[model samples]
Target: MDKKIVFITGVSRGIGLEIAKCFSNNGYFVLGTSRSDFDLAKVLSSDECLHIQLNVTDRNQISACLDQLKEIDKVPNVLINNAGITKDQLFLRMKNEDWDDVIETNLTSVFNMSKLFIKSMVKERSGSIINISSVAGLMGNAGQVNYSASKAGLGGFTRALAKEVAARNITVNCIAPGFIETDMTDHFQDKDLENILNQIPANKMGNPQHIADLALFLASSKGNYITGQTISVDGGLFMS
Candidate 1:
């Protein structure tokens, strides 16, 4: 069998970076994309890893990425729609541009990215797609209306797409992370952090590795049977 290739978006740092490193350490060729350029070798010494500058919200960039992959003869077996952004604002105060930007980056980008790869996947009759969502999408948050709605839409996208490609051996799934200790949360004050921690039953904040490990499982053959479902990894903060 050819060596497996994994394509990850927004992989410069945080959970996406961890997932790339995990896959590389496990013998998968990594093709990671970010809006800004990043040196993949800085974190891992894998010759098989390639980092591409991609703006997921741009259709031209997505097409160019597909063309480049085809030229390189890299058929990605796993596609992780991990690129997303948050525009936090109260509903009444939120700007229209904020909602549009959040929706385009977080949700519409998934549609474009998935469409770019699903054809080759269907031709091969095998693939795995993992979406990185947020717990805000599940239980909702006070000031992240746009962010939450985008993530919530991912659930519907995952289920419908899963059914469409199930017969073709492709699986689509969503992962919602809660209060992970990433740069996204680094801006919180100590008091704010303390308040957030109290809500989590784990008492400690979750790490990027926690999300990465689960993403690995879902992308690998281990999670072949799991599809059209949203799994939360929030230290038991929001239990359904």
Candidate 2:
């Protein structure tokens, strides 16, 4: 069997980086993208992995990265849209730029990426697209209106795209992760952290590897039947 080719965005650190490493270790040809040059190179040092600089906020950068992938004949079997940002402020106080930035990075980029690659997957009649949403998308949070909107948009995008491409054997799904231990969450105060944990059934922060493992399965053959669903990894934060 040919080795799978996987492309992941925002893979410099945290969950994205862990997912990249997991795919690479499993013998996939992993291509990871980051905005930082040094961090991109550092994360994808192995022969099985290639790192490229990509700012999803910039269309030109995304196009350039696609061109590089085409040149190398590395069309991906799995495309993980994990790049995102948060501009947290109450809805009333949120600046226009803050809302636009979050939408561009987290929501619009998925549309761009899916449009770019879904055709190829359609032609091949097999592929998987895993989007990283958040539990905040499903359950609204205070001071996170923009972030919530972006993530919620991703869920809609996933379901619509899944319906569009289901006959072509392409699965589109979103993983809505809860509070995970990463640099992003590290910014929370101890009190805030404790309050958040108190709501989780597990009563602890989820490891990055746990989310990575779920992503891996969703990208693998075992997940062929799964599509148009938002699976939460938030230790029973919201049960629906």
Candidate 3:
């Protein structure tokens, strides 16, 4: 049987890396991308697993990458929009560049990638798009107005796109992770980490695999009926 293909962004490390491992383990051909170079030999030696350079924010780069994929006949059955940036600041103190960067990287990139690939998916009548959002998107967080707005916009984008593609048998969903133990959260001061842990019913941060497992399910046939949903894997930090 031909291996299924999954295209994932921001896969140099962290949640994106874990997602690539999950799909690769499940016999999917993972086309993982990152802005920086990475050593894929550490995790996947399979010829099927491809590591590509991509700046999701750049439309030209996205087009070129997709064109290359098409040349290799590696159009993906699944697309994961996992590349995002945080320019966190209080709205009053946030710079215009910070807000613009976050929105473009986190939100607009989703639209650019989705728009490019969705045409093929529509024609094929099968595909899954899983967006990696954040719990901050669901419940607003202080000092992250720009981040929150970007993710919240992603949720709405997921819903609207799901409706548009449902008839074509394409599913669009968002996975909003909360307080996952990644490099992104490693900079949290001890006191800040303690305060965050206190709010979670699980009393701990989530594992990146927690989000990966859910993403795998959503990308697989098991999740055919699920679409237009923001599934939170936050260890009970925000229940919704």
Candidate 4:
């Protein structure tokens, strides 16, 4: 196994799946996860891929996956905290469960996953942790207070973690994507989508591949010097 290993969450579909493919295509071994059952091997031609049925918010399930990695003697060189969900509703109408679920999955899962893997990276003196955030985290969204807070918390988490681990040669960063064409937006009507596209100066929705490409770059040697930064891929939707 000369190829580097990357562990990505939420690989059942959308951006996570695209990142898995991109890494595998670039000669990486992919250890991917999803809340739902997914067969990544069917989509990836690589024999070096493994898929885990995982709920990122669950420590027990995450520990089970940790056991699987140990069985194969694989320590991920990169970790992408990509698993997330959005229960969209007006702040006045939001449920407590919605807020809790979003925070646990979107924010705390970063804590869970990173804590599990960072030990090995620290021992090896090399690693990259990429947190997938959202523009809503930076700019706020009308119907997504929970989701926004979760991702915003991730940015803070990334920066502080980056500083702590930089001495160990591990880098932590966040990617805040604007409206990408994933299932998360599949519910949007044409008119609703038009309103979103209108907001983006580029006047278009980005594909999952766009996000995947950057993930590759960040995990590569080219990104060795970059850390503690939130890079937005939102077609100029939110410039900070």
CA lDDT scores, all candidates in order: 0.91, 0.88, 0.91, 0.91
Q: 1-240 in candidate 2: lDDT tens per residue?
A: 154999898888899989988888888888888888745445556777788877877878778778888998998979999999998998899999999999999999998887778888988999999999999999989999999999999999999999999998899999999999999888899899989999999898888898899989988888889999999999999788
Report how far residue 71 has shifted in candidate 3, in Å: 0.8
Q: Root-mean-square deviation of each candidate, in angstroms?
A: 1.1, 1.4, 1.3, 1.3
Tens digits of lDDT, candidate 1, 56-86 = 9999989999999999988698999999998
- How far off is residue 157 in model 1, in Å? 0.5
Candidate 3 clash figure, as a count: 0
TM-score result, candidate 2:
0.96
* TM-score to true structure, per model: 0.97, 0.96, 0.96, 0.97
Superposition TM-score, candidate 1 onto the true structure: 0.97
What would the per-residue lDDT of candidate 4 be over residues 108-181, giving only the tens digit for each residue?
99999999999989998889999999989999998999999999999999999999999988889899999999
- Give per-residue lDDT, candidate 3, residue 7: 91
Model 3 lDDT per residue over 1-240, tens place: 133899999998899999998888888989998998887656776677888888889899989998899999998979999999998788899999999999999999999989878998988899999999999999999999999999999999999999999998899999999999999888999999999999999999998999999999998788989999999998888875
Model 3: residue 205 alpha-carbon error in angstroms: 0.9
User: What clash count does candidate 4 reach?
Assistant: 0
Once fitted onto the true fold, the runs of candidate 1 whose alpha carbons sit more than 4 angstroms away are 1-3
| Lowest-sum lDDT 10-residue window in model 3 | 39-48
